[model samples]
Target chain A: MTANARPILETERYRLRILTPADATPRYLGWLNDPQVTRYLESRHRPNGLDDIRAYITSHDGHAGFLLGIFTKTGEHVGNYSMRIDLPNAVGTLGVMIGDRDHWGRDVVLETRAAMLHYAFETLRLHKVCGACLSTNLPAIYNYRRQGWAHEGIRREQAIGDGGSRVDVVMFGMLARDWRQRREMEQEK
Target chain B: MSAAKEVLAQAFDVSITEVPDDAGMETFTPWDSLGHLKVIAAIEEKIGRDLNTEEVLAVIDLASIEKLIAGVHRV
Candidate 1:
């Protein structure tokens, strides 16, 4: 957590590090092009190429915020987590995609989210952290609700979904105090 | 499931043994929106307070309900 040092995070079973242009591989491109993997993500709106992925990764060089690669202990890259901050508001917006179908339903989301929340609140010391998902994504909606994130509101028919159907965007928010309270409660358990 | 079996079983109107380990929105057939709220209400009654968003979300299924009302199943 030292200043000016590269941030590399490790949980019990996963290691998360910033993704660079070199990290963009055909497999990563495959994920962006996979409808099943990107179903609930905004990325599904358009196709992506290797150059696009590289540029996206290059844009977040950790100057302010960066894209994190979610990796297994065995060095397999399964997904991506992006963090963007509004310094004036001291708020962060997180976007995630578990591209690897093999890792679905395996608690990777829960584990990685805990790590990112800690980094967001404890390390970054941000005032708030939030994420949004399409309303049609039942599993994500269920996760956000179960995680106790405040349902800020929903943007009705925010975007188009598969088959040209419109979908609402649901937002969830968590404040610094709320994070502390949740942690304290976890300790009491 | 010992802690909240009666509550879940009663809400779903089934025997306690009928509740499976993976009973959730996706797995449990009866766990629709109404059933979810029912479980939430029962958990609230057991805890003696209304569930906050976080607590409500934690009670996704039978095991979560047991965890929410911990110590009831341990004994």
Candidate 2:
């Protein structure tokens, strides 16, 4: 809960901890190495080698926000979530990667996203937060919509993916004011 | 229509018709585990209020939702 040490963000069911080099192998490698896992990620094709992972860790060593390792109360590593600070824009881009298939369809991601959003808005003082996903990722798109992000637009065939194919990304965003409104409505209900 | 019905409909993306006449714990589909939090979020946004966990769970029907809104006004 302290600012310096990465604190555990407790929800009704799960806790999130900041990632470290020690989390490199089990948490990172487990997902980074899986083609199915990284299919929608920009770095999908990056060779999932130890050297590559080490470089990736170093690259994100002092990032403005964090790439956190999410866990259950029983101390099971479930997946990853990120809060990327865009200082120039005075906003943040939130991301989540849930590796455990068992946890899908349970709304854990939605709950976790909400918890992180609360922290981002209340603790970090962010002006806005946004998310993006492959146009084909229906679950992600649906979840984001349910979480109150607006569909900004789509990029047409902008990036090449693992198979030399192009993928269009659907973008979504929410301002602090809108988030506040949504939170207020939830409270009143 | 009660204020609670309006708020709940807007939040769950459902029409007023979707809510049953005897809607309670058994009637609302979106009133499930996850949707409950979202319903809470929508209510907070519409009325600019905060709800404690006890208050949120105490909500079982439209009347409770209206009561919560009324209590906020009283404060």
Candidate 3:
């Protein structure tokens, strides 16, 4: 999709940009409000309104964290990639949300991770990027492995699912070295 | 019926031609969570046994599946 002048990262089919306060639209608020959309996200626990969205967007200035909007070539905001950086440790924890139902199962999250991981390791010079998902979120678990993150460990019975069942959190990590090797492997292929 | 790629292609409802040389769960569109479960069941049906959670998760790629099938046949 055609991107704005400043994109944090660009993939084959996505433009990742830091979201602005004005980018907080009613549709975005609806995604957070929709249980089907936010079921796996902690944000699902609370209802998010325009003001909250705007405030959160502004809070991230690309230094401490980024509220990046993933846009299609046609300029539709289908999802977001959120990265929270720990300056002292040089680690970033990332999460993805494909708000648009139409984009589900389309491998958007996979591409988003590839682009953002490059940014985190190369641009930001972060030492590592990590993410965790609920054990029951099988798609996410497979993505973490497919994306080349080491399955660091699991926090047993860490969280409760919507069904009121305890679910473990699977931790994943990728160091700068791992990212380099992955890129090298891609080049070799 | 005994080929790893064939089993995966069948489980994912795709043709063997579509699968990559270094085939893995990520490379295919239908190889998601549900597809993963189907792959496990398909493999079990071919091997004529059930797989444990560990064995199921270890089916990371086509090569791994091939190795698992070979090991089962050896036994």
Q: Which prediction has the highest TM-score against the true structure? A: 3
In candidate 2, what are the lDDT values of residues A64-102, reduced to their tens digit? 666777888998878888777876676888888888767
Interface CA RMSD of each prediction in angstroms: 7.4, 11.2, 2.7
What is candidate 2's TM-score against the reference? 0.67
Q: Where does model 3 sit among the CAPRI classes?
A: acceptable
Specify the poorest-scoring 10-residue window by lDDT in model 2 chain A.
A1-10
- Cα lDDT tens digits, model 3, B39-59, are 877888878887543455467
Evaluate model 1 with DockQ and give the value.
0.10
> Each prediction's DockQ?
0.10, 0.03, 0.31
Predicted complex 2: CAPRI docking category: incorrect
Return the clash pairs for model 3, or none.
Answer: A1-A73
Candidate 1 lDDT over residue span A32-140, tens digit each = 9888988888887776999999888987757457689999999999998898888777788988888988887666776788888888888887889999987666557
Candidate 3 lDDT over A25-108, as tens digits, reads 988988998888888889877668999999888877667778899999888999898888888999999988889988877778
Worst ten-residue run, lDDT, model 3 chain A? A1-10
lDDT, model 3, position A136: 63
* Higher-TM-score candidate of 1 and 2: 1
Better of 2 and 3 by DockQ: 3
Each model's lDDT: 0.77, 0.70, 0.80
